[model samples]
Target: MISHMRRLLSLSTAMVMASTAIAAAEPSAELIAAAKAEGTLTTIALPHDWCGYGGVIEGFKAKYGLTINELNPDAGSGDEIEAIKANKDNKGDQAPDVIDVGLSFGPSAKADGLIQPYKVSTWDSIPDTAKDAEGYWYGDYYGVMAFEVNKDLVKESPKDWADLLKPEFANMVALAGDPRTANQAISGVFAAGLSGAGGDVAKSGEAGLAFFKELNAKGNFVPVIGKSAPLAQGTTPIILRWDYNALSDRDTLAGNPPVDVVIPETGVVAGVYVQAISAYAPHPNAAKLWMEYLYSDEGQLGWLKGYCHPIRFNDLAKNGKIPQDLLDKLPPAAAYEKAVFPTLEQQEAYKEVITKGWDTVVGANVQ
Candidate 1:
């Protein structure tokens, strides 16, 4: 559910957000030809609406005239790596050529020898801290956690994490994913605790567990996988999701049920997702080409339209490459100002705490 890195200088990283330089390398003609020759590019665990991947995929296919062999739109980061491992020797349609996963997964995947390395043409545009020095993985886009509320069902949305504990919210609140596995849900737990812990990243993991335990005890927590469908149908009126997902849900619903995406006043945590070519990619050239397209300005803006802050956003904005309309589509710049970006180490540390303790501490099994 996340890539996740970089502190905000409003739009993520004070250094990155202030940079005005723009460097882009063109894909070699031979590489483009080779990728076209491959004819198809396999991708796993990319939901069309998440991070505006729907438009990005369509744009890629339309631009390259190559078929995208998409697999497991609902699969998690773990499933993506397993796909590569399972198909290491297979060269058929079931094989995946690339993956977009959580930031933590990138290094672990590289360590496991499950991913290959290829620097995109716009590689220099991404922040150094957000990418692998060896080019094993690179941050693609990121967003913070938010409350996606069905306005048709709930009159007043929770303004902060504590507000969700109100008696009125009973059986209404839900997590977008199973905290035991989904990065989005795990981050949600961490964010909840951050406000309670006075912004202590180290203590958020445990504090989040306590917060959820309390919410569950109050019968305000719904043990259900909160998705757009569930939310629209009122099964889960308030779902914790990445801002991009929540915004996309609002646009998709089109006011039929109305949606309100709220960035809590406290405990703002951002997560970055990274991309990499598979180690055993059958269509390696195509995978590299896809990377090039993803890092391109066109590709980055596609994500912006979907409400994700592309990893290269700082450079894009400083150079005036980002359209004003696109910028306007985002939630207010002020809402993002105080976001706390947990380092990869902190994310890993908290991830272990939450994933390992969610059951025993919170005791609500999200389906």
Candidate 2:
């Protein structure tokens, strides 16, 4: 009797799991209606070589027969934010339909009341930690900070956070830029902190600050801003950069000095590029449609082709959509399986830590 009951319970649990997934997969009728009424979408994005935003835009236009009125790619998140603030009042004519900004800027945008809430029908597809409860923004693609070492410079690559501090690597390491100025660099700092070097902004910024100070003292730190390609090409042998960028660079230079990307054994810091609809969007309908499409399996696949991790993890797993060959290209998916998602609390705490710490440790003597 006991064995029979246990088997039945297990079967019931499986059925419940299947039911929940089916319900979650269903799209929202209300959003579909709204999208049909609106005929176009306009978006703003920070410039990135691997985001695959162009492919996403083209696909949406082709599918919906809706014009993507604008795709404004600014130099950085700060520039995109400035454009939104400058046109907040003109909801219908001047404001953008959607905006893609770095993870750090998402909270600031929400606090400033520049973002509007509209949960895409595919909301359940996104990881809960990656989206706001009230639906202000949602992460679409995330990149982890990893070591990009030039094989020619060092016969043996650095495999962990501790390896970066070795005497031999002195004056040879370069970070993207200061955390306050660049999201990529800030992510590297967070990864360092997570790796046990000390990143608790609330308790103490000492660990993170000291880590940089030590690097500075050893002359291992090279401050490069804006362009990372030149640094990767050979001017600097080892660089702290996102895996996608590193891999994309390596793919581009197959015949040249190869760049090896490694996720440090200690831990990795993941930075997410998120999407939000402008509070005063001029093309609200088109924007809603774009959001819906981007969260779909088709959109997620586009991201995979561009070498970005899809936001809809479950779909990717169920459909077996991610190519096995590309899967081999990435760090074990398990490495990122339980990856940390930056919270609003963490972002707020680190903002002060990064800003002050950057001046004292990095910005004070930049070339």
Candidate 3:
């Protein structure tokens, strides 16, 4: 009789564990109905190819059948926060329901009351280091900086940050965004500085400014915000962006332009982009539902398809959720070995030095 009881107890424990897992993955029926009633979610600064957001967005729409009103596909991380701040009083089309921005912007956005807190179902799976205690924002994905070049446009593709300044690259090199407001562009400057400073992160901002100043003076730099289309067309032959974007661009170009995504030999800086809902979100339920979809296993894998390392990577890997083929497609593990992640303080400090000095020190207004 005791043996029978033990077996029943074991079966009950297994059932409870299975049910708990199911509960975490699926949203509450009430939340889903509420989101459906809202019928829309507004987002800002989400380029389709960046970080595999294109697929993720499609999956959400197909699942929930809600219209996602996309706003400003090319806007920067700072611009996303500004959108929330500017539309605080207005809850209609202009107000964004959600934002995906750089790591440094998370705390600032929360402190400024531009974002509200809502922990997703998979919140615990996210690393504590990458998320806020109050859940205002959490890391979505990360990638190291790299140069994406149109191989057909140039005889020889440069391999490092210094090579971009060579005369051969004259009128060819472009930053991914305006350093004044774009996190990617600002991080591009910081990465170049890291290369210039021989990896002293504290000195990266000043060193980056000097590097761009020279790139501009030598007529090598293209003063424009860059995108995959521009890179393929040779308008901007060389663009500094996250490795994931570069890889995705290469795939999208698909040998017509024959792109090369190269990780610099030095100054390998990795940046993390975070996700949050707006404090003044018009479709608050849909926004929360969107967050749920992003942090879910399916959403995480979508980002992986775009070549980004999702913030929930560790948890996914530990559970054997990641596919072998997906892992095989990424750049070699060795290339990422030297990647350095900057602290929030370091990024914040350098951001001030870079943004405040870009106009005066670099003297090139990137449109």
Candidate 4:
């Protein structure tokens, strides 16, 4: 009787341990339930039209019945960081649950402890280069630099970086934002460096900065923010911005002045944007679910629809999941295939060079 009682007790303890292991390993259903209970998610800097967040967000809301409060639609990568840092102590809807920022910002945010590590179910599908090993941040989509022009205002569109330095583009060239704080402008300078350096641009190389300095000296670099308004009014006839932004402008202003987006013949550089959860997210489970949805096939396709290349495009293509019609609408894959992505360390170093040297090397500002 004593031996039987001991055996029963051992079995009971083993069962309890096994149950605990199962509970720990399988939390998806519980997470989903908890997320639904939360019922609300606050986000920052996601423009409805930019990168198809308009559709993506609506879809997410409908799918999960969650309320999404999108704050600061026109904010930049820096703004997103500020939002997270400012709201670290806020445990309400005012705090941002997730962030999407430039690749350079990812490492900085992770290092600053502003973001947390959480790998989704589809983590393995993301390329090793596009995500942190521990999942602090992961690349969502990327766009190449392009020249957006108002064809009606400028009869001649610049085809390459060197073309912008020509006499005709004087007082007409503009960047989306300041390089010191904007990834788009930094990428423009990087692309110019590649073109000026004979297709071998380094992250911290001076060739790009030199080209911009010349542009400033020539009075071709306008100190103005590049946006659809400036482009439409021809205040900044030529704007250096992301391909998606330029293309979106083309469609948005179809009958107006007719914007022309040109991929520079030389120095084509791609910039990746990463997504991460705020370290102090109020709805942690919902945030994780958001990450899961963003990485899933539906979310990736939503990005493609918005004209950005999803990080998991290759994986989706291999599985024959991408529709051919949708594939056809994308910019030639070869261009992006040949594109270069700076490593996190390289991006950080390059950002330091640009930010520190922008005032000294390229003082030109865009109004």
In the order shown, what is each candidate's alpha-carbon RMSD? 3.3, 6.3, 7.6, 11.7
TM-scores for the candidates: 0.93, 0.78, 0.93, 0.88
What tens digits encode model 4's per-residue C-alpha lDDT throughout 60-177? 8887888887788777788789889999999876799999999999988999999999987777666676789999999888888989999998898898889999988998999887
Deviating ranges (above 4 Å) for candidate 2: 1-40, 46-48, 65-74, 90-96, 198-205, 226-228, 319-326, 334-339, 364-367
Candidate 3 residue-wise lDDT, 211-297, digit = tens? 999999999999988898788778999999999999998888889899888999999998989999998999999999999999888
Q: Which stretches of candidate 3 lie over 4 Å from their true place?
A: 1-24
Local distance difference test, candidate 3: 0.88
TM-score of model 4 relative to the true fold?
Answer: 0.88
| Models ranked on lDDT | 3, 1, 4, 2
Clashes of 1: 6
In the range 1-367, model 1's lDDT, one tens digit per residue, is 1111233723344446433333455688999999999999999878898989999999999999999989988777767888888999999999999998888888889999998888887776788878899999999999999999999889999999999999999899998888887778888999999989999999999999999999999999999989889998999999998999999989998997899999999999888999999889999999999999998888999999999998887777667688888877888878887788788899889989999999899999888
lDDT of 4: 0.79
The residue pairs that clash in candidate 4, if any, are 223-365, 223-366, 223-367, 224-366, 224-367, 225-367
Better of 2 and 4 by lDDT: 4
TM-score winner, 2 or 3? 3
